[model samples]
Target: MSQSVLPQSIKELQHLLWTAADSDYPVYVYREGPQDGVIIDLSKLNEIIEIDPANLVATVEPGVKLGALAKKLAEQGLRFIPADTLFYQDKTVGELFYEGCSTISSLKYGCTKHFLMGSEVVLPSGEILKTGGKTVKNVTGYDFTRFFNAPYTDFGITAKYLLKLLPVPETRKSVSVSFKGIAELLAFIKDLKASHIVPAYLLWVDLGEQSVFRTDSSGQLVMMEFDGLSEEVSEQWKNTEIFIKKYKGAIYEVSDGCSEMASKWSCLYRTTDKYVLTEEIKMPFTAQGEFYKIFYEKAKASRVKASLFGQLAEGKLNIVFAENYPQDTFIENIIEAVEQAGGVSSGKYGRLTGKRPAGILAELEHRAKIALDPKMILNR
Candidate 1:
C-alpha cells in the first residue's frame, strides 16, 4: 500500500482515484492488459480474514481476486462461487465488484450481488461504514452488498467486502444440448428443470452459425458442466447423455477437459477483443425467455440484433448488440417489454459504461449522486 497515492479524506480520495481525462475508469476502459488504474488496491495485506469463520462468511480487502478467494476457501474445502473473471489471476475484487463486471459463469453461480454478505466502504464523507452480518439470516438492516450491482459510483465506494461461501460440490458435471431455434432451446430447458438436472450454470450461445448444447463436448457439441459427489456426477452425466441422445445430439469430450471448456461459454460477452463496441446492457431474466418470447422474437427480427444471456434463477439478463443501429429504440422497446412483464429496469448499465443521454432513469441516478454525494467527489 502506497500511502502517497492513498487518500485519507473523501474529497482527496475521489481526486486520487479518477484524475481528470488521464485517469482510467472501469466503464470507459475495464482492462488494459499489463496496465490499468483507478482501483482500490490493497496489495499490502497478505491475506484477508472471514468475519465469522464458523458461519463461512468472509471480509476481504478490495485487492483480493475472485480466484484467490476461491483458492483460499478451497483449502478449507469450501468455495466462493461467483462468475470467474476472464483474468481471474489478475482482476482485483474491487475491480470485479466496483467495476460492475460479471464473468462467463454468471448465468449459474451468479454475479457479485448474490454471494456478497457485507462491506466496509469508504463513503464520500470518508467515513468507514460497516454493514451486513456474517450469516444469510442477518438481515437486520438494509443490505449494502446488494447495492454494488446497482451502479451509482457517485453515491458509494466499496473497499472491503464480506462474502458467503459454499461447500465445494464433491461431484461436478456439465451437459450441453442444442436445438434448431430458441423455441427448442426453451423447451429443452423446461425439460431439464422438470428432470431436476440442477446445473450450476445454464446458458444459450448463438454463434451466428453452429450452436451446441452440452456441459462438455459431445458430437453435436452443446456444452455443459456438472459438479457434486462422484456418484452424483455419474448419475447426472449418464442421465444427461440419455436426454441429449433423445434430442439427436452427439457427445464429444468428457471429464476434466469438458468442464474446462464449459467455462469458456461466457467469453462471448467479452468486448475488449472486438474493440469500439457499444455498452452491454442487463435486464431481468424472465423478461426475455418464454416470459416474453414474443418480445424477444420481435427483437431478433428488428434491425438491431442483440445477443442475450441470462441468470434466469437470479432474475437477470446480460444483453449486447452486434449491430448497433437504432440503439435508443432497441433499448426502449426492450425496457418497455420488460416493464410489461412486471419488472423494474434501471439505467444502471448506462452508468457502468460511463455514458448516458439524460433519460428518466439517468436523471434519477444523477439526483441520487447529488443527494448521496453532494460533493461530487465519488467515482461517477
Candidate 2:
C-alpha cells in the first residue's frame, strides 16, 4: 500500500518527516499559484533563522523573492538580469522555480542554472542532500546540485539554496538596428561581437515588416537601444553608425517615445484578450529566418492578409495577420514548416524552458507533486 505525504509548515514538515516511511507511489504537491503545486518550507519549522549572502555565494530560505534578492544585491553593486516578468516582489523563489514562472530576461543570464550555484534540497524520503557550491571554480566530485535545482520538480523539493553572482558590468546599454535582410542583421551582430562593441541588450528590427521600425509610408525604419555610458557607448554607437552606412540601413534615436513603440515586444500573456496567440515555437536561428520568409509568401498566396511583428533582440517572430481566416490552418502551416525544417512547435512560452517530451514532462510534473507532499495527502 502507498501512503500519501503532506507538507504543513516548516515545523510540521520536520515532525511528519521524522516518522514517514519510503514510498514508491508519487505524492503530488499543489502550489499557491493558479496551477496546482507544493514544496517543503523549513523556515517555517525554525530549523534555521537566516540564510544570507556570505561572500561570492548567497544562501536563501527558498521562500525569498528574486526581486528582493536583486534589491539587496544591488545595495552591494550587483544586479540580476531577468525579463521583469514577476507580477510582484513578494513571491518566493521556491514558487518561481518549481512553478516555472521565470521571465524572458532570464534568457540572457542562462536560466535557473545561471544564478543558482548550489542548493540544500530535501529529497522525497526526507533525506537532505547538498549540490554544487558557492563559487564557479569550487565544484567538487559529482555535480548533482544543479540537477536537483532545475525547474524540473521530478527531482525533489528545494528548501535552501546558494547562488553565485558576478559583479555588475561597468556599462550596460540597449540598442536597436534596422536592416532590410536577415543576412545583413547577422553580419552586423557578428561585426559588433568581433569589434567588442558590447551591448548588454542587442536587438534587431525588421524595417520591412515590423511596424515599429517603419517611420513613414516609404518603409524607412530605425533601431532603438539603451546605450550604457557616455564614453564606451559613444564608441560603440559610432561603430554601429559606420556599419549602418556601409550596409545602407537607417538609424533612429529612440527616446521616451519608446514606451509606446515597445508595446509590440511586450509580454505574450498580455495579448490574450485581443490575440488568439499561437503557441510559441522554437527553432534554430537559421530555420526561423526561413520560416519568416516562407510564412510571408504563404500568407500572400492564400490571400490571408496579415502582418509580421519581429522581436529581433530575442529570437522570437510573431505572425498576427489573420483577420477572417480560420487560425487553425494558419497555425498548422507554421507547425508543419517547423517540424519539416527541424523545429518543434508549442503554443506555451514556458514549455521551451521545460523542454521534455510530453510523457517525460508529465512524469516530472507528477514527481514534483510528490516531492512537495510526500503523503499524497495534500488535497485528498
Candidate 3:
C-alpha cells in the first residue's frame, strides 16, 4: 500500500518534493488508480482565494471543489463555463483543470483549458513555476501554461489557478426528441448545424437494455440545450421545434429548467455491475454514422450488450459495454473499425494501439521531463 501525504502549505510541499528527490522515492499526485509509492493528496489546500467580479476572474486553490465554487460564483451572478454540467460540480477545481474536463457546454465555451488563464505549479525539483496571470492575454516566453494544461505525464503539481468566468444565463431550456434510426438523426443534426440557432450542446444518446437512461423503448434520443437571455432561448426553442417536426421526430421531453435532463444525461458516465467498460471514440461528422453502424453491428454479432451517448457537434461518442464481455478482442475490432471509418478511439485500449509522437516533439517532452524531475521521483 502507498503512503499518503497532505502538505498544509506550499513550503511544506516543496520540502516534501526535495526530500523525495534526494531519497529517490517515487511521489505521485493522487488519482484514481493503484499507486506504488507516496501519494500526495491536495484536499487540505482547498480555498477560494479570490473572486473578482469586475474582471470576471477567480483565483482558487487546487483542492477547491467545483460545486462549491459554482454556488459561490452564482451568488455573484457569475459561472465557470466549462463546469455548466451539474456532474462536474462534484469534482475539485484541480482535478477538472488537470484532467482537461469538458462538458456539454463545450459546444459554446470550449473546454477547461480555454477558461484557465494562469497557474502556479510546483516542479518535481521543488522549484515554483508561475505561468500566465490574472489578465486574459498574457502571451510571453514559451507559453508554459499550455505545457501544464493537461500534464498527462505528471510534469508538475499545480498549487493555484486563475480561471475565467462568465455571467449566468438568464434562462436555460432543453428539448429531447427521439429518432427511429441514425440516418434521420444525422439529417436533423446537419440541419441544426446550418441553422442560425446554436445550442449549448447537442447530445446523441443510444438507449439499450444496459443503459441507465434507457426507456421502455430502445432508440436514439437527440437532446439540445439552450441557454441565454429568456427571449433568445425562447426563440431558439421555437426554431428547434420546427426542425423536430420536419424530421418526423417524436418529442420525448421539453424542459424549462434543464436540471432534470442534465441529471438524466449524467447517468452516461455512471458505472454499474452490468455496464462495466466505457470507451470514448472521436471521429469526423461524416464518419460518425458509419462508425456507429459498424461498431454496433460488431457488438450485436458478438452478443455484447453496449450503449452510446455523446456530443453530436463534437463528433465524440462514449460507448459502454456489458460486464465480463470479450473486451480484448472486441476492443481490437472496434479500434480497427474506427480507423477504417476515419476516426480514432481513446482510452486504455486505444492507447495500447495508438502510436506515440516521434522526432523533435518527443525529444522536447523527454528533455522537459528530465529537466523538471532529474531524479524522476515525481509520479514514478
Number of the predicted model whose lDDT against the real structure is largest: 3
Q: How should the candidates be ordered by TM-score, best one leading?
A: 3, 1, 2
Q: Candidate 3's residue-wise lDDT over 94-140, tens digit each?
A: 87766545566787768667788888998887889999987756846
lDDT digits (tens) for residues 7-113 of candidate 1? 34444444544452233232111222122334433443324666355887777766666667777777787767662322344556666665555444554565656
Q: How accurate locally is residue 367 in candidate 2, as Cα lDDT from 0 to 100?
A: 72
Model 1 lDDT on a 0 to 1 scale: 0.54
What's the alpha carbon RMSD for model 2?
7.2
TM-score of each: 0.70, 0.61, 0.89
Give the poorly placed runs of model 3, Cα more than 4 Å off.
32-35, 208-217, 270-278, 301-303, 324-326, 346-363
To one decimal, what is the Cα RMSD in angstroms of model 1 from the true structure? 6.4
CA-only RMSD, every prediction = 6.4, 7.2, 2.9
Pairs clashing in candidate 3? none
